[model samples]
Target: MRKFLASIAVSLLITGCTFPGVHKIDIPQGNVVTQEMVDQLKPGMTRNQVRYIMGTPLVTDTFSPDRWDYIYSQQKGGEERTQKNLSLFFSDNSLQRISGDYRPGGAAQ
Candidate 1:
C-alpha cells in the first residue's frame, strides 16, 4: 500500500510538470507612438517640439546624432511578439521627416 501511494504521488508531480498550468502575462516594452502624435509633427520643428509631441525615443544612437528611433513591442502570453518602429530624421537640429510602420494622420490608414 505504501509503494502504491508513493508511485501515485510521483506520477502526479510528473504530470503537473508537463501540463501548461503556468500563466504567462502579457509583456509590453518601449515607447508608444500614435498617428495623431505624428500628425502633430511639422517640417523644421525643433528637437524639443518633436520630443514634446512624440515623447522620448527608445533609442538614440551616438553614431547618428541626427536620427532618433522610437520602437514599441508587445508579447501576449505565449504568442509571438508584435512590434512597431518609427524613425525621425533631423537636419540642422530640426525635424525633417518621419518614417516607419505608421504614417502621419490618414496617410496610410
Candidate 2:
C-alpha cells in the first residue's frame, strides 16, 4: 500500500509539474487597406472608382448609403493587435469626405 501510494504521488507530482503549451492563432479581420491605396483616394472620386482603388469596404450600412467604412485589424500570438479605419462619405454618388485612422496629405479633415 505504501509503495502504491508513493507511485501515485510521484505520478501526480510529475503531471502537475508539466504544463500544456499555449498556441495562439493569428486573427485577421476586415479589409486590408494600404497607404498607397489611401493615397489614391481623392474627393469627388466616384463610388466605383473608390472601390476599384481600395477594394470593398468592411462595413456598409443600409441606412447610410452615402457613407462607406473600411476597417482592418489583425492580432498575432501575444503581440499587440493593430487596427485601421477609413470612412468615406458621398454626396450625389461622389466621394465627398474621408475620415478615420488614416488621413490624406497628413491632414485629418
Candidate 3:
C-alpha cells in the first residue's frame, strides 16, 4: 500500500511539473515613416528615388504600376496600437500625389 501511494505521489508530481516550450513572444514597436522623410520627396522623383526615401512598400499593387502603398500596422490583443497607411501615386516617372500623415501641407513638392 505504501509503495502504491509513493508511486501515485511520484506520478502526480511528474504530471504537475511543467516541461518546457512555454513562452511569451514580444512584439516590436516603433514608427514607420517621419514627416521629414516625406517632405524631402519632390514631384520629379522616380520610383527608385521614392523607394530610397521610404522603405520597401508594404503593398505594391499587382494590377497597377503607378500606385505604391505603404502601410504600418500594429495590433496587440483586441486593440490597434498603430495603423498608418501612406499612398503615393506616380505618373510618367514622377511623383503625382502623396497622401498620408507624413505628407507636408505647405511643402513645395
Can you tell me which runs of candidate 1 are displaced by over 4 Å?
Answer: 1-23
Two-way lDDT contest, 1 vs 2, winner: 1
Pairwise TM-score winner, candidates 1 and 2: 1
Candidate 2 global CA lDDT score: 0.87
Ranking by lDDT: 1, 2, 3
Error of 3 at 100 (Å): 2.4
Each model's lDDT? 0.89, 0.87, 0.75
Report clash pairs, candidate 1. Answer: none
State the weakest 10-residue window (summed lDDT) of model 2. Answer: 16-25
* Candidate 2 RMSD to the correct structure: 5.5
The TM-score obtained by model 2 is 0.73
Runs off by more than 4 Å, candidate 3: 1-31, 75-79, 105-109
TM per model? 0.77, 0.73, 0.61
Q: Rank the candidates by TM-score, best first.
A: 1, 2, 3
lDDT of 3 by residue, 5-107 (tens): 9999999788663535434343534437766778788887898999998877878888997998877766654344677778899999898898875675445
lDDT of 1 by residue, 11-70 (tens): 999887456777778999999887788878888999999999889898999999999999
What is model 1's C-alpha RMSD? 3.2
Question: Model 2, 12-106: lDDT tens per residue?
Answer: 88876354665767998899887778888899999999999998888899999899999899998756999989999999999999999887765
Poorest stretch of ten by lDDT in candidate 3: 22-31
RMSD (Cα, Å) of model 3: 7.2
